[model samples]
Target: MICRSCNQEHNNNFCPNCGEKRDVEKITLTSMMSYAFASVTNMDKGFLLNLKMLLLKPQRITSEYLNGKRKGILNPISFLILSVTLYLVVLELFKIPKKPSDISKLPSGTLETLGNMSYKAGQFIRTYLKFFWILAIIPLGLAQKLIFRKYNFTEHLAISSFIIGQATLVGIISYLILRWPLIFDPVIYIMITWMVYRVFRTNNKLDSLLLAFVVLFLFILQLILITFLIGLSQV
Candidate 1:
């Protein structure tokens, strides 16, 4: 097969030269509909391909990337970008909470800052969620580094990014179905546990569970700390 992106000849599922998936369907009405559906549903071929690999064979995907097989699907950062984009869109479209609880308890400085701003603290968080997300991943990467000492921090970061991105997607779907934000917590835990377990390929279930919960706890703590700091800035 000829690679679509690089025009190189290859006989495998992916082009050796450019890493483009082989045997891409020629455009037709059906193909167009499929594309439209995938786009609307956030399940495009690339995304679905990545998700399938991650879920069915997490270790394989992680190892493949670490071993220099970086093609044929979305990379971790790209996956995260898409997830965060969807989150921002959903947050904007829906009238969710814009004020964190205990706003009244904020110091005078923080209150003053909030008063001067056109947007609330929650609005700020929602608007620049991607930034917070990246921030949250730093500690997570560190935690994974401690647990999976075999991999470097950056490699652990790639794994963390994919896990968080996939978990966010699941959280969004859970919220849409249950119409309750809290319900998404379990969904996140479930997704993270499975993904981490598979990626690490650990034999001890306790290790995976502990790592997942620790990461979750640290992420939540970071968010709370950030929220507190944002409020304190007003004072």
Candidate 2:
């Protein structure tokens, strides 16, 4: 038979030029089921493998990805999207306590109260979760340029996305844990720092520690800003 892919003439099962396998007969229901199961098995195996690599050898994985060895590893953006989506869904399922001073509970006495509540809600979402990528991306890109000596913003962006993705995963876990047993905000911050350091190959432990502190401080400041805006809106 003539193999169209390689334009090769072959009398046997595969093309001699490009090794294209011969087309099989129409798939039966049983064959389809088998194929589906096989696909599922392969997907599960790949997911687990990638997950383990991401957690255990995060630095290596990031380096490999930057070096263009990215076939088996999960794409960083896809990983980020999946992780963030899952985290948000899980967080919705398990509610976190808002501070008593939260503007959402402010009495609706005036237009200010309404505006403040709206602003607070928007700020809370943007500062805490929605704008995380935007805030982290630029700093992370700069960090890469400084630490790894990589000037390519795209590469830095990839690393930044991965770090944030991992951080979001940790944040979700921390949120879940804080729901019942503990409020380990410090630990969560540490984990996020560690994830960023790993991704960026930041060798200086002190610098990483400082960066972590800055990140926590910024988060707290964002909270304060949101609260202040809420109060102002009420006035």
Candidate 3:
């Protein structure tokens, strides 16, 4: 059989050249519906199992994923996306708290400009919160890729995704128990500290812990950078 994708001749269930299925199914209403349903509702991607393994051994997931382990685990970006979705659902269901005060009401002057920027930044953090959470991963990944130089930028992104995904889950739990969701910060940082240590896994415990603190600083710096950019764009 000639592979339709790469045109390599092979008689097998899948094309060895590109791994495309040998017999492509015709697009029918039933098949389309099934595909859509699976894409949306497929827990067989192993959300719970992946979450467990992610907590236990995040670094392993990053390495194994790059090594082409694609079965029974959620990809890093997908995990982050799913975590965001779950976080949003919990936020809606629980109605966590009031958002930051309206940015429109800041008093006029340089003070007002600064205040407006600050207010808008707070609003940005809360509104479209999921997108902000995802963007936070970018700076972190870039920082790790540059600083560690152990893995390439893409690998660092996978690590960052897992870190943020786990953060979102921790935030959900904090949101449930805490009256003020602002408390979510300390909890998330603690969890990420552990993740960072595990990812780097140095023999020097002190260095790893300090480096984990650096990870927290990096995230905070990214948040401020994003806010600055957003503020400037509106100005």
Best by TM-score: 3
Over 158-194, each residue of candidate 2 has an lDDT whose tens digit, in order, gives 8767766676677777777665311135555566567
- Per-residue lDDT of model 1, residues 1-235, tens digit only: 6788998988999988878988777799998998767754564345666677777787887788788986666788877778767865775677466444554554578555665342354556555667877565676777677666878999888888888777777777776665554223677667876777778767787877777667666656665666667655543
Clashing pairs in 2: 112-233
Report the number of clashing residue pairs per model.
4, 1, 0
- Tell how far residue 172 is off in model 2, in angstroms: 2.4
Native RMSD of candidate 2 (Å)? 6.3
Write the residue-wise lDDT of candidate 3 on 1-235 in tens digits. Answer: 8999999999999998899999998999999999766655665555665677677877777678778887877778888899888888887898845655665677788978888777666666677677877877888887676557888888788889988888778878887786445324677767877888887877898887787778677767876778888866656
Best by lDDT: 3
TM-score of each candidate structure, all chains considered together = 0.66, 0.60, 0.76
Q: Model 1, 107: alpha-carbon shift in Å?
A: 11
Off by over 4 Å in 2: 1-46, 96-118, 121-139, 142-148, 180-188, 201-235
By TM-score, highest first, what's the ranking?
3, 1, 2
Off by over 4 Å in 1: 1-45, 97-123, 180-186
lDDT pick, better of 1 and 2: 1
Ranking by lDDT: 3, 1, 2
